[model samples]
Target: MGVSPQQHERESFRADLDGNVRAHALRCAPIAEALSGATRASRIYGIRRFFGYFREAAGAGWVLLGDAGHFKDPAGGRGIGDAFHQAERLADAVGDAIGSDVRLDHAVAEFGRWRYRTYAEYYGLAADLGVAGPIAGIVPRVVRGLHARGRIDGVLNLLSHRASVLDVLTPARVLGATGGHLLRAPGRRHATLGELGRLATTEIRRRNAMRKPVFQSGPAPRPVQQETPEPELSR
Candidate 1:
């Protein structure tokens, strides 16, 4: 449902309106065919593309939930669902610590950390999906292989936020798909090799980001103070 067309920023604001829309729509064959004979209901309008970003979720006396806390590109269609998830968790965190100022501060601070940890991995994937460029990797080949084997649910689940990144696009699957592509189209061996290198580099960056996230904000978890009960007397 999302298309990351590879058009430059300057070209997006060009004077050739119809030419631009047609070229961009034609990036997907089905979309082009569907709109070929379709009539325009209104003059064309454009939306500026948004890159993903994250920020602090909560602080001392207040807490920000949902998109207020963080936001990502809309390519993954996760906005509504993630908003609901954040709202529900924020409500719970508040409910558990409402009676005490100290507890409330600690709870919301922990909530912020929890929020970051929950979406950190998926955040990179969503941003990648929204990047403006041609799909230059084994993704298409692996998708075709999954289709042939009737095992593409993992990809569907991932888009729906029900699965992890490596659930379906494992290293073994990538290797198998790359080998298959070379066997079928040996002439493009060099191109495929280059694509593989890019894929590896992208993964390395993703892992590095995971280890040291650049967008997250919050202090490390502080241990909660608890009243210790006196040791039970022998009975």
Candidate 2:
């Protein structure tokens, strides 16, 4: 039996051939050796591109939680832990509303709002970082500075959700990196300044393009209907 071109492209794994493994020999001896001796064939099993979204959080008596409520690129390893945190907050909100004077719907509605506020910035950052390709723009310079200061652990923690993006990419670090690049040799300085201006404009346009419910994960939410009063029977 033969596989279709599309199927082969999507599923077949050709081992025992030159790929990028040779490129790693100097830095990663184990990977180079594995590539040298590997004889097994298996499918590639990692995400090939980015896919993520946000969805309506609550309606009537229904509540969406975890991936059903929202999902972002898993690159940062935040999904499972985030779900657990959400569950805890949700349990508290629902329990209090049930036992107290607050309406259950109101409690859940507020939870939804809180959820967005808490995660939106991180959502944008994750999407930006998870994009496939070399990391670009000012980030590399900023990372270099962090490395020089022995603070790269903060970046690792940011990815693992133990720290915030702002905590690591502070104004001082960003400015310092930009200033350093701007002070490079004249030819390099000109190129660096142009790139910075271009990236800044792109960033501004991106922010302006963003709208509420930034990404819709599923079907559009159904509109709420108001209850109507029944007319009294004629006397």
Candidate 3:
């Protein structure tokens, strides 16, 4: 929900708070519903949260990788991907540090450049409408034009943990291909689960009622019984 104390102060914290408990948090900068068990559903039904990095960076005086350097909305779920990629890049620098030609300063510079660029793209994408349901008090919903802005693929590879920042561009291309399908679907612009539930509950309830008859049509076929016998002991 990205429902932070800061956001709560600014906008009266209107984000939905309907998630179920998965576990308790130990004061870390940090929900459940019926699951779809599909990739898209998995992305949606889970609660989203993100940590901001600027505060920690200002307080600490060392080079930071990841959201410590920058962060994006957990709505997109790209922060982990972004951090993982940054770590991979850092590992290369570590290797360089171990070699005769190590330049710790150069590695730090490269990391800052890469981190800022990644944050630039990430922040720009997140700022657009339709990315995080609705930004606090900007509007009732995301504008139709920006509804399908979609997740950047380099970003998703970062999310899935399958690729590093060096490999994000390829996935970015694929995300561009079908990312707008839902937005383009008739009346899907600005749609969210709350909007969908309003329209579908009646029909879904009816369907569930219809399913009951089939379920009640006598007992389902019984499983064939099987038993395991004890092994014979040696004489």
Model 3, 112-131: lDDT tens digits are 55555445544434433224
Q: TM-score: which candidate is best?
A: 1
Per-residue alpha-carbon lDDT of candidate 1 for residues 78-186, written as tens digits (9 for 90 to 100)? 9889889888888888897888999999989988888887777677777777767757669878888888899888788888777777887889999999998899899
| Candidate 1 residue-wise lDDT at 104 | 98
TM-score to native of every candidate shown: 0.71, 0.65, 0.36
lDDT of each: 0.73, 0.64, 0.40
lDDT of 1 at 60: 92
Model 2 misplacement above 4 A: 1-50, 99-102, 198-211, 214-235
RMSD of each: 16.2, 14.8, 21.9
By lDDT, rank the candidates, best first: 1, 2, 3
Error of 2 at 156 (Å): 3.1
| Candidate 1 clash pair list | none
Report the C-alpha lDDT of model 2 over 55-109, residue by residue, as the tens digit. 7777667778877787776655688888888898899889867854348888898
Q: Which of the predicted structures, 1 or 2, would earn the higher lDDT when compared with the native? A: 1
